[model samples]
Target: MAYEFTKEDLKEIEKLKTKYPEVTPVTLPALWIAQNRFGHVNPEVQKLVAKTLDLPEAHVHGVATFYTQYYKEEKGKHVLDVCTCLSCQLCGGYDILNYLEDKLGIKKGETTDDGMFTLNEVECLGACGYAPMLQVTNDKYVNHLTEEKVDNLIESLKNGEQPEYEKIGMPRRNNIK
Candidate 1:
């Protein structure tokens, strides 16, 4: 089936567009809407976004590729982006990452067989003080991680529980007036 935005998604896009003088500035929000609705911003989704924004496909694709937050292909329900920056590294971030890999039985950048989790070793999540942190689906950050905590997190996620996390840094500006 051909990809298309839902009515509500279109409405949200329109609402977001109102914040900008022209559609070009709406690219990020539009791509975000597509990713949130469809999971990942695939080529087809990029094309649709390009069409919606009246921009070239390459332009949309470039914008999506420029940001690590935008997944270009299908990802698991939960994506764990572990911080491997200097601060996190000093705090044993790699150990936590390796532990996750061993526990999940999937290497970094690969999804589990059941498609529940995907692991990624990402750059700084801006939680230098917290260190050893991971972000789940841009929703929350798991900070001051321990192996036991990682185990519990995996189990909780496997059980469909929204585990509470100790957020690390200041909130990102996702909503612009």
Candidate 2:
């Protein structure tokens, strides 16, 4: 199927382009808008972005594929990105990853049969202090995770609820005061 960018999307992309001296930098945000509109940026959508900016399709594809956050294909409603980087690994990130696999009955990099969740083994989400954490749909970070907490998270999501947790804001600079 052909992908069409909404007029609003084009306008947004236009606005973003103006912020940069050249159109190359606009590729990232354009892909973001495409993903938000189409839920994913497959080849066709990448082409659309490239065409919209009058750039090469290969360039758009490269940018989109470079970021793990961008879904190249259609994904489930909820995506679970298990962080298994250095800090998370030391804090038993793999254990959490395995736990989710078993609980969801799907291995890492697989989506649930019910089409609700897609589990991913990601490197880092920049929350080393919140080790053993998994990001919910690239939005919420469930941190300091344990088996019980994971269970609660699953239950809440199953019940059509977004599990809420305390967000650790960026550390305030001591020099500010």
Candidate 3:
């Protein structure tokens, strides 16, 4: 597949290159743009980026695999990533993951058949206060999640509604009134 950069993407990539001085310096941003544009960093993109920056395909793949944020394979519209660090695990993280697995009928690292959602488990999302948190797309749902809440969140997305983040079972910050 031949992947051509969009006009806007080219402009942004040029800006990134000017700011970074070296093409390697903008590797992350460039990879992000490619992922956002093509939904995944297919082999075609790897080749194009390598050619653009005069780097090798192996080098480009190295950076892409290093970051967990980038997806190499095609993903559904929504990606649900559960935090499975020690903190989250200790705070009902397993149950939360189990619930999502059961609810979505998909195992970890798998996408649903309907092509609406993908379920994955990742390391800490830096929201330890909300131990059992999960990120859907760009938004994070904090606290120990219950099946009902997860179902509600999924339904809301199905209905084309953005889920509002409201603290539920997670510990609150201090200095509150």
Once fitted onto the true fold, the runs of candidate 2 whose alpha carbons sit more than 4 angstroms away are: 169-177
Give the TM-score (vs. native) of candidate 1. 0.91
Q: Each model's C-alpha lDDT?
A: 0.92, 0.92, 0.82
TM-score of each: 0.91, 0.88, 0.87
State which candidate has the highest lDDT: 2
Ordered by TM-score, highest first, the candidates read: 1, 2, 3
Candidates sorted by lDDT, descending order?
A: 2, 1, 3
Candidate 2 lDDT at 107 equals 96
Question: Candidate 1 at residue 129, lDDT?
Answer: 82
User: Which has the higher TM-score value, candidate number 1 or candidate number 3?
Assistant: 1
Q: How many pairs of residues in model 1 come into backbone collision?
A: 0
* lDDT per residue as tens, model 2, 39-147: 8899999999999999999999999999998999988888999999999999999999999999999998898889899999999899899898999987899999999
Model 3 per-residue lDDT at 115: 89
